[model samples]
Target: MPAEVDLKRYSKRFANLKSKKETPLTARIQIVGIGDDGLDGLTGQARQLIKNATVLVGPSLLLDKIGNTDSKRIVVGSNLQQLQQAIKELGDSSAVVLASGDPLFYGIARYLTETFGKDRFEVIPHVSSMQLAFARVKESWDDAYLTNLATQPLDRVVDNIRTAELVGLFTTESITPAVVAEALLDRRIDYFTGYVCENLGTPDETVTQGDLQSIRTQSFGSMNVMVLVRRHGAADRPSGSAQRRLFGNPDDLFLQSRPKRGLLTPSEVRCIALAELSLTPTSVVWDVGAGSGSLAIEAAAIANKGKVFAIEMDAEDFALMIENAKMFDVPSLVPIHGQAPEAWKELPDANAIFVGGSGRIVPELVSSAIKRLTSGGRIVVNVSSPDNLVAVQQVLGDAAMQPDVRMINIARGQYQLDRVRFASLNPTFLVLGQK
Candidate 1:
């Protein structure tokens, strides 16, 4: 039969069947996950439900299978709203929604249930792409860290991945496997074996495996799953190295410059100032007069996924900032080598600002930086001298919105040989203001 004739006959048959069944049909919805092998991949019950559905909806790629449907058919590219509307319009009819892989594993089942209530539909899940990837690789994913790059920040994902022996990630356009590998390589974390499983569970399925260095120079197809397996004994040495029980970290971790040796803000003071800054994972922060960038570096670690702009006027400290940022694996900390207030121009307003300076310009710098703070933002100043404190308090106290101040006297215990002695790093005062 001719193609046009077949379509006409098919439509007539559907109309005839509809007229014969005059009884009111019960309204129902079914979400089905189809694999690369198409409908044959479906289970017995799932296939039967799809075959008898009165209305079918799915992405254009999946809709090709039921294109000859005698019932209503809708092809959606990416408009989820249109799909929802079509589902709503298919009231009192047996409607089936088609999706790729398992519908519930990071799929549409969750959204559909949330949007239309759980009792209104049934979901038939299939083999998820992650399961298939693991099967192909012959590896168990019982302990692997899994996350979606599409919804999470790449920096955060990389940060959490530091301790994982194995990781499985769903990559987005901006965070492809190559980009992820590059990020890891930049942090000197290059001991993982990388793999990209493309077109999984299909005839043209291709799995490309390589080390982080090799993967950093490769490309992958759109449909793929990224996996990372850290080599044995390749995990971060001296585990819990990032965690600090006390307020201070070992001074050696920081990239310190000579002549400015003691100028680096002690970690004890930096900890209190950071806490006063009200740091959060998403907070935008600035560290002015960031000597050796110690405060900003530690602040960056505390605010893992947040943005930290470390502005330093000294040339040597600015260079040290970059080295410290790399050592800490904090890609979000930006080292700005210029004077404050003027250096912060063109950047987004900060949610928190930390000022550490003993210079004569402390008062003016704090006042200028405070103006760029967002509403409800916090400002913390660490000043050692009583004169600088008085100067800053005078300006801040007179501002339209004045901040609260506190004096922090931190003392640490030192044990040399068999004798124990108390060593006071500094008696720095912290002033906190909110806008």
Candidate 2:
């Protein structure tokens, strides 16, 4: 018995030493893209590869769908480390990894190929679920914004969806069609016709369609894709329902009681001022001396995810500004019915500042607001008189690339007896300072 035990110990030591000296596995992995239809959906070549595989690795759901395979199978889950360790341990074993839809389209193929050598694997792709969803909806997806809910936060995704003509989303278990529908409705984005496609390519497959309000109340199967199609002639904003003009909306769209008319910024100047602000989607803007909130309202629309504070002392203009914001469905615009320099004391620092006034105080207000602007922030001021313009430019300082100054002289087109005439507007000076 003692002699037999010694012989076994010697044999184990020899095997261990041999394993340490041997090279790592060079076996190639076959990654097959399969649909919900399982093996029935795979091509003949893919089926043969799986049949010949010595080891198979995939999600348990996919593995179950491809049941009774003669190959040794390893189930992959959320644990990426486990998957990598399993592959490393499968030395000299030819393996096949199955994934859903197009393997490279937000699937396991990209991860696997990155972890292992790309040259060590072969990929066979099927139609992606996102493609299938758009196809089922009969929509062209060339320019459509596509995102995966599993990867991106729904809040940030909703902002992009606001302006997107078409959006295709891959739904996750926690963030489902119902959650997305509710989010859209909450943002007052009601123009899209929502589609929920579930269990695609399977016998129990279903495609559900409804408006945002209707879809908000519904549930869906775990495996699904949600698509949103913005209706024809729909503006990129809910405010478009009331104020449909793209950028420099007409001043008449705003409610300026009796004598306050013509106090709002002209469409031409509004466009110029907005462009100079260099605003992003989440830029915080301050429109001081905001009469009827024309520039502030438009800025709020452009910075969809940002906040805009419209500071006006006039009660009538302040009320008008509030009404105009709601009229344009601009939920991000906050009407501050007090004077500036003090009204903005408690508000957050701004990214872009817009000061509009014909008086001397306009330049000083712009100067004070500039102090509150964040680094790399922008400030644009529109002064009607030449003195205020020069004073504003002086406060902005004269760096080589510092301030941008422009004189805006606009004219309105009019027709009299089929003859065209132009009505000239007073010359206004604009100074844009970047800090």
Candidate 3:
């Protein structure tokens, strides 16, 4: 009896020693991405992590892999608010969350980290469905225009795809391949071949390839990415040779007001304003006196996810800006209908500023806009008359340094019986200032 008691104590002491030598473990949230193949396809580390988890949280499709649901589990569906509540209530419990592909790549990792902080969790990722689709098609996706159709508007996604060699999209209940194909065809963008990769990484995975017009006629599964490769010499080699054009695209392409014709801020002026703005992909811009929102719309396109406020005093021009934004497929333009200075009061500090029109209120507007601009923000003003141009230059020069001003005169070629005539547009002055 005494010998047995001594052996038990010795065993307990050895167990404590072994635990102390091993790495420390804690209660944490593990976000894992799984493919369609299910359990048999999970990595060894992923499998062990799931089996040892005290609490599991995921969608129904992922929950099926556990084989036993007796453990404390939370089923997540489309309710992000509910998911957040569930996670918050989990307090002190070790949690294992299941997601669809790489959690960090448009998955739950961002939300979890944002809500619970990065130190509170660990991520175990699987092959992303997009990666699998690209693999199935035997193509590298390093430069592919990738975005989730679930979160982005159809027009924005289509516009981004318009200029890309390949596109990978995470689709949802509404935006499918047929719908996407129809959109591209409607835009007269029929110069490319299309491919749809569906149910990738699973046994029933399939890849379908056809021209944009041909693909429009067929239907595809829910999980898919519409890939496009431009055909040889498709339409006029796209405006410029990728070096980035400084000015003058087709005027009809922009959103312009009806009765008040030629209200669009010309492309030349727009380029100069953008240059003065010194825009980055994330700079927030405010286009005061935004006529037809030409400057604001282009600024939004250049600043991708950044925000742009298109403040216009005219109702007709405001509506036209909305139409133009939809046509350009730029999502960052926020159209605000009101007079400047007063309208800009509620907006966040702007990184760049653009003021247009030859109105007498130019000086006051410039002063008000400068106050709201962040440090080092650039401002550009456009004027049509020499008088207004001189006024703007004086105002800007007094507030900051010697302003850089330019006179822009553009002429388009028109075909005649035996020659080309120079059809001239309006001449304008662009004044750039900084604070």
The candidate scoring highest on lDDT is 2
Question: Please, what is the TM-score per model?
Answer: 0.51, 0.56, 0.52
Candidates in order: C-alpha RMSD to true structure:
19.4, 17.0, 18.1
The 10-residue segment with the lowest total lDDT in model 3: 236-245
In model 2, pairs of residues that clash are: none
lDDT of 2 by residue, 136-187 (tens): 9999999887888877778768876876778999889899898998888876
- The CA lDDT of each predicted structure is 0.78, 0.83, 0.76
| Residue 165 of model 2, lDDT score | 78
- Per-residue lDDT tens digits of candidate 3, residues 49-128? 88887888999878986578446789998688988988888777777889987888878888889887898889999988
Ranking by lDDT: 2, 1, 3
Model 2 residue runs over 4 Å out of place are 1-25, 238-435
Better of 1 and 3 by TM-score: 3
lDDT of 1 at 125: 86
Candidate 1 CA-lDDT value: 0.78
Model 2, position 403: C-alpha lDDT score: 71
Looking at model 2, which ten-residue stretch has the lowest summed lDDT?
A: 234-243
Q: Which stretches of candidate 1 lie over 4 Å from their true place?
A: 1-26, 65-67, 237-435
* Reference-based lDDT, residue 202, model 2: 89
For candidate 2, the lDDT comes to: 0.83
